[model samples]
Target: MSAWIRMIADEDADDTLQEVLNLARTPHGTVDNVMRVHSLRPSTMKGHVILYRAALHDDANTIPMWLQETISAYVSILNDCDYSLANHWKNAAHLIGDEDRAARIGRALHDRDPAAVFEGAELALMRYAEKLTVNPGQMEESDVTALREAGLDDGQILEANQIVGYFNYVNRLLNGLGVSTAGDVVGYYAKAEG
Candidate 1:
């Protein structure tokens, strides 16, 4: 799968683009197609890297890292963005460290059956993400009330909201740009925090 627009390869990047590309690179020294798509505008590329790290990898997020990745994967599934789905699911699985559990969760999310893998407040959060992804205009204040009722504090709810929102934004960006995982390092860019 190739991008609809031309992507500057690492070898062909100007000095500034090369620096920005470095920020987006995985441990394997390869860049994901999603980030590579921003190569034409290095500022966007830099902004993407910063936004991505803050959204999901920041130390301040209260939710577990694995669950955050799960939220990202769930959003990807809801949006039908295979590029995001594949990348995020792999990150979730790696963060989980249990192949069977991660696979089951992946199956349930892919099936759009959140109840199969999540319960209680987690399930409520998943439901919120689904609604926000599929029916943003219909979202009511009761949605936040439900998360609060399910034991999520405002900060936690905000984190979930941002994760969902971020994925929705990137999913559209990747899909609209025709970005695919081909020639990209899967899950290598994931910043795992303890």
Candidate 2:
């Protein structure tokens, strides 16, 4: 599909976005198509890239990368945002590389209890993110309490919420704008048969 969004370089964004694009380009290759479409609106894209970097490489009491990926994939499943789900599951595999954990995550995607400890708690964060993503108006104190019970401090919970909410925005923009993937990432993931 033709991407419905175009990168418009008015003045400074051309430089800034180029730099960010360079950073995204690595052995992993170019940023995903979702990022490409979103970067057409440079300001939003840069901010998101910045926040995502922080969320993954947190400066505070960081959530474990494995746990974060678990949450990310679960949230992607709930949102049905294909790129997020695809990338994050691979990320989880890379970080943990445990077949049992991946299986638990697969089960959790369907709202089944994860066979791993803390897996269900991670899913709770994801499901809560789904609620906040699609229905911010209904967010209540109880949701925060549930997250707290799952062991998120207020800051961590807020950060996760922000990440979830931000990705929801990205998901909407990317999907509606007809973004695909960086190259053949989806196909590669499918072919991995993991």
Candidate 3:
């Protein structure tokens, strides 16, 4: 929980808030502090879950779950958001299931050297994520061009863009609210949800 604001615990939640909380709850029956912080407004909590599902969990999304998590981890890294970086990196690592590859991914993100771990479209999208997180204002059409040249279609590029944007938004939200990852089970997600 954030030290700056009050969060409604699961036991204290009203029916409506409880319902929204369920959408974001882990399989282990705990809600991350990031989602719990929205307890005051159940709608926003629902909105967060919906947006998260669409951005990172929707079946319609073409980006693989592991790569999506990678993009999220990378964005979190650039934002210096420990909560998201730790959680998302764990997600990426869990999905990858290769400790050495996951370590390489982590190191490359930390070093801001996507080329070290990714090639072709993956590399291009990672570079785009880094740029968007660090210098969004400096982005130009040429960045899109580079992604296309690297073999990413417009749809995949948009998927990457949405992921990057979503993480940036949530990173600021978590940081702004002083949310902590103390009780969260990193990398956990409901099998049926995102």
Report clashes for each candidate as comma-separated counts.
0, 0, 0
Q: Which lDDT value does model 1 have at 37?
A: 96
Q: Please list all clashing residue pairs in model 2, or write none if there are none.
A: none
Q: Say which candidate scores most in lDDT.
A: 1
| Residue range with the least summed lDDT across 10 consecutive positions in model 3 | 185-194
lDDT of each: 0.89, 0.65, 0.87
| Candidate 2 positional error at 70, Å | 1.7
Residues 1-194, model 3: lDDT tens digits: 55368999888998998888888877677788878988998888888888887888778788788999999999998999999988888889989889999998889889989898899889988989999989999999999999999987888888888899899999999989888887677666424334
lDDT of 3: 0.87
Clashes counted in candidate 3 amount to: 0
User: Among all windows of ten consecutive residues in candidate 2, which has the lowest summed lDDT?
Assistant: 185-194
For candidate 1, write residues 53-130 as lDDT tens digits.
888888999998888988999999899999988888888899899999998998999899989988989899899999
User: Model 2 over residues 1-194: C-alpha lDDT tens digits?
Assistant: 23766643324346777776665543345455655555666666667667666765576736677767766776667667777777777777667678886776677565734433444467567658768866889999999998888877888787787667666766676667766664535522243222
Q: Model 2 off-target regions past 4 Å?
A: 6-17, 26-29, 111-120, 182-194
- Candidate 3 to truth, TM: 0.92
Off by over 4 Å in 1: 189-194
What residue pairs are clashing in model 1?
A: none
**Model 3 alpha-carbon miss at residue 97, Å:** 2.0
lDDT for 66 (candidate 2): 71
Off by over 4 Å in 3: 189-194
